[model samples]
Target: MADTQFSLVPKVINGGIAGIVGVTCVFPIDLVKTRLQNQQPGPNGQLMYKNFRDCLVQTFKKEKFFGMYRGSGVNLLLITPEKAIKLVGNDFFRYHLKQEGKKLSLTREMIAGSSAGACQIIVTTPMELLKIQLQDAGRTATVEGSKAAAVKPPKISATSIAMQLIKEKGITGIYKGCAATALRDITFSAIYFPLFAHLNSLGKRKEGSHEAVFYVSFISGLAAGCVASFSVNPLDVVKTRLQTLTKGSSDKTYTSWMHCFRSTLKHEGVLAFFKGAGCRIMVIAPLFGIAQTVYYVGIAEYILGIKK
Candidate 1:
């Protein structure tokens, strides 16, 4: 790896921009993924959604175009800090872990990535908890309605959800799935950062720059994002299930990640672990692709005249 002046301001700006762009483009797919993961099989093995496409269609049919972005308010608002912490934290760790004339080993890379992942959980857990509730609310409301009088689900907002959670469970209420979120994010970063770095390194560099060409970085991010997203999907499923606290009485409850993993496997079969794997890959690939492209483009650096 090459050295650049370590500056937080530009990196933070770049990360926030990357997150906003990526999330804007892919939030709908992510919403679908959450619904799929949260959906439980009905009595007699029926599922609300046949698959990702069905889920998308149903959401569009019921909620229309903007409905797909149901929980985007909180996600978009918090993702700036969430991504800023993850990306910038990774860079901070990697820069510190690098030794003079020593190659950055894979283990160290993973450690750096994991550290970044851990650091972001402070923001990620609460953001995801609120986002999941809002995202899955529409689907669950419809399901509950089918068993009773048909009525429109009440409009819910992120602020309302946060306030309710805080009032009920105090501040920690919003971090209902912190442990599961940490597991998913740490594992994802451990896999993604090292792989992205290695693949990005193989690409042709700019004339005198250590950075790979923008397209190469984007492709590297996409590929790594897909693999990492797929690998941690089971954890993501578990996390989503854990965070969604509004399940009906019949829904199975899990006390921990292992318990959820085992229960889901036993009840829904092994495939349950990957309920939204396809949507996850779709959402993550382009998300990281655009994010990496933007990050490497140094928009903040350009605006601030900061030399890398």
Candidate 2:
């Protein structure tokens, strides 16, 4: 009887729930992305963000707890659309691929994830720029020993920052880092969804068991967390630079995506690509994964009556 009633609509609902929960829960990592991307290396020639502890402490002392969550509003705006694209797109790709008899392997999942990621980039880029500028207010450039200790940044609020951006650059200015932003959404989705599906498959249990589904979700969440970070780290750095650069730019410096990438790489060392990876793993990935897993499993059971 249950087999007769199973359908794709409930699967989509569960997927949407998972996407929303994942993005919302891991939002702190989004802030972390802003901080890492916007980081200007200290005078000591060392990397700015050593990890989560350093970034967190610095943000509290310099920017404040509220400061860390700079573009939270923008995030809320991006989540629904991004999540929809990520979940629905991935599943759609999976369905088509299966029709072609593609093996449900990690590689196949990555391809589906990559496609979904690319799709979400269009929806997510502008909001991502808003997030970046909000978080970059009075961001410190030097964190070397005494200099790091002595620096007290200018006071600013999200509203003030928004106004400041408008006055300085205009609507386009607020979205200055859009290309990079697109890159982030696309890259993460590409890595996250596929890895998640793979892990869930790994953790599959006997039919009609809530405990089994929960465990599968948990493992899948962990894999998605780790894989998403790797695929999207470089794009994240570029996104941060594009959005966060204010005083440093000439008229044309922030003009295009190519310009942003080349300039950031030229000025900051190659190592800049990996600025906040550890913190992201600790904060963003795990939180997002857990949220995603719960949403996926919970939504399905809710709609389908525990798959009895």
Candidate 3:
């Protein structure tokens, strides 16, 4: 029992560190994904940026390089706890759900992953709200025309945004799209964790190691993340739109998740649900690859002198 308790501490630390590393590495791609997902067609039915590459180029050219990292500060700050809760929580549930022989069935794994996904939404919602706000800020400017270019982008500090959200809409404002966020995350973890585990297990270096090499873990996570990311991208798009849309914006407002879904399908067509699928795959692939490798490598254990 003591050993089990001791082992759990490392999972939390490693998960947090992995999140920082992964988010930092793929934030630019994630920025592009957010923009692509949130953008709607103009009057002529032309989109702001044609594709991920176009979005990346335009953002750099217009908003400059730092523009690609608009919400990185708050994202990085909140990602630690968010990931700690997710990865650690998954492991916690998995440990508890394991059978007498320390075996976890696929069903149990999915349950554990789902539980972790649900647990993280509390942090994920507000964190994502702030992130989407900052990420979509540039697009908001473009949509508004002259007034947008004339005025400087608001210096969106986390503290300021938090204060403003609280003053205007209270804590609820920070969770604008909780339902969509939950759906996306739950589906992602349900697919990702079990798939990753199966792939990782197949590549284990030796019996009892219960750990794949860095490359194996990386590849497993990348593949699983891409598949999982693409699968739930529609939900992701809805979540992004719901979170970023201003209350009284010229664009349509989504009163609920179903409204967002039906409205998007009706107006944007089916393909709109997949606007950022490619970029999302790219972002999630590396994000999970790095995260899985980092977690499996147990670097945090060595640093913290917690290795068994």
Candidate 4:
């Protein structure tokens, strides 16, 4: 019975295991998303990203699989905390909440998830900023590269990007878009966790038995993924913008989150808010379901001595 729950490994170990596997699975779409979000307006201030397949093909043609995997090697940044927060912290909340005698509802899930998402932004933002530079041909994070006559990007490394942020902007540079990212996290994770919990519960209607972990897990994942995407689509765009700023730029002029958001919308449009969302929905929504559901039902179960 003890083995029927999470395995004996430390929560961090379990989270690390899940994060590495899950983030690697979804990185390509994430690459495309960063590129699309950071795209500069054309001469007429036009938007980019015609479609997913076109971007994928062109990316492979230009950068090969390497191109498509921009910032991928450094993905440990995004993966570590993301998995830790969701898998470990999220589960922790459920366990704790259960002991409180208050009814477990979607609200608990949302609160746990949102908190984790907020932490993830801090853990992930700089790496994300670097990824944007690698994905786009026209932009780079280095002083010399941004200023060169050709403006060709140097081979910016994840280590270099982290170092550069420290040198240029101090600790603040690394936390560039935290307010926005926090908001994004708060809304989306909040929605996803509770939604998933509810969905997972739906599969248990037939009996109070704990046997249907896989079905419950899948439904929970699917619901959480869909709802989260919808709730925080705009904030995700804002988070990306704040992350992709070049070094030494003055963000002082922007003043507030609304200012930056309005500026993007004014220059772009409503559709600008949803640049790569369709691809994200198609990819991330489903994968979110598969990741957690698989973890709880299949992968974690293996560790827990359950077979189903």
Candidate 5:
């Protein structure tokens, strides 16, 4: 049976609230994941962070605890719309794809997910660019060594960054990594939704029990997110690099997504693609856990007093 029938407004509200909560809970791990993904080995084959723990320790030591949340304001702000489009759009498309009383085929589910992922890119690109810029700021400073410390860091408001990007490269600057973002997100959603659905179905609870649905949703989302996030880590790495803004350099790094892929593989080897796999799994697992639980629980419907 279908889990629930939600109107468009309720779907959006549910998605937005779930996204905010999930992202807020996992932003720190996300920051670390980005930093890990963005780092390449030096001539001596040394990495800035040996592993996730090292990255966490060094980031906190250098940038402080609050620094872990550097780009979270913009992320939290944009994630609402981004996730609303993703979750609601998924259901919207799934509704159309479903034949009455028949479960959606795996292919149909994947198509629905891909559509949702593609739809969110319009908002995701700019939001991600801003967030990556902020999250990678400390890494850039660390790379620059003492010289970076001499110069003060830019203030951390999303408005200031948006204004600066517009001034520097016009509106197009905000969408610096659109291609990579679309590629990663599309692949991720394609994998995530279908897998989550299958897993959730395997562990289905009694019909109309919200509590059972909530717990099952959390477990399924967590499992699906870890697998999907790891599978797409290479694409995610390329996206992070493309979105990140470097200091005083107007030039693009690695040309295009294909170029970025080729360069990373050639230079850093296959293992480089999974640089932040652990941290990414951690971030995504909990993120989807919280998000899916909240979404399934129908808190938005309850708060808004819309009957299911």
Candidate 6:
């Protein structure tokens, strides 16, 4: 029989490990997605990247291999807790939301997932703000350098960014795109968790066991991630633009998410909202594939002599 008891410590540890592994493997792709989403048309309607391929090629040519990971330090550090809250928080809610001896209703499952998404934004907002800054800093520097003399911009780090935001705008300064983040994450999780659980349930299970096979979980996570990532790409774009502090003089400032949405729709059109969608799928698929597999595999359980 499966272990019905919830063990907080093991779940937290497993979530942290899953997060670290997933972020490390996919951070480069995520950086590309951020850069793509942040790219706005120039005064003459010229864009920095024609497409994802162009963006990847340009980044490789200009920034090299290491540059692909520009903002990864902060992402890796904070993603641990952000993902921990998201994954384990979902499980925690699902465990409680279900009535004893009854399957959880799909609505309750969505609520549980949404609650997890809400819980994670406390860390996600600041983490994303700093990450977008660092990831897009190179693009900003590159554009400026091309127009001006070929001088490299001074290096900036996550610690410095946090300190400056704290000093200049207080602690709340770091939560620049919180509303957008919440919309994207909550929607994504609501869709993703239910879909992943459903798909995983349909897959092959271990002999005489309730759990799906590891590969099944991975595939379920990947499929769910791709669908959810694509579905929320518009919100992701808005969030990226809102959080970006290194806007050119021509860039428009928005008062809120609605303002940003309307302005972007008016200026850039609907297709603009899908910026970096492909890259986001690329990043998220492997991320949650690896993350869910590791999480379900119960590494902590093995270590601590707990069975699930």
Question: Across residues 1-308, which tens digit of lDDT does each residue of candidate 6 receive?
Answer: 32578789989989999999999999888888988888777788867778888778777766788888888889889988998999999999998888877888999999999999999999999999998888888677766666434334459988998899899999989988899999999999999999999999999999888999999999999999999999999999999999998876556788899999999999989998998999999999999999999999999989999767
Superposed on all Cα atoms, the candidates' RMSDs to the truth, in angstroms, are 1.6, 4.9, 2.5, 4.7, 2.7, 1.6
Displacement of the residue 179 alpha carbon in candidate 6, Å: 1.1
Residues 200-307 of candidate 5 have per-residue lDDT tens digits of 877767575533567788999999999999999999988888777774232237778899889888877899788888999999999998998888788878988986
> For candidate 5, which ten residues in a row score worst on lDDT?
146-155
Q: What is candidate 1's local distance difference test score?
A: 0.91
Query: Which portions of model 1 show Cα errors greater than 4 Å?
Result: 147-151
Predicted structure with the largest lDDT when compared to the true one:
1
lDDT of 4 by residue, 140-238 (tens): 332223232334345667777678888998988777777887787677777777777666656764254554466567666766677778667788777
* Backbone clash count, each prediction separately: 0, 3, 0, 1, 0, 0
Off by over 4 Å in 2: 1-20, 42-51, 62-64, 100-108, 138-178, 182-184, 209-212, 245-255, 300-308
Better of 4 and 5 by lDDT: 5
Model 5 scores a TM of 0.92
Question: Quick one: ranking by TM-score, best first?
Answer: 1, 6, 3, 5, 4, 2
Residue 50 of model 5, lDDT score: 80
TM-score of each: 0.96, 0.74, 0.93, 0.80, 0.92, 0.96
Q: Between prediction 2 and prediction 3, which has the larger TM-score?
A: 3
- Tell me the whole-model lDDT of each prediction, alpha carbons only: 0.91, 0.63, 0.85, 0.64, 0.85, 0.88
Runs of candidate 5 exceeding 4 Å displacement: 2-6, 147-156, 204-212, 247-252
- Residue 83: error of model 6 in Å? 1.0
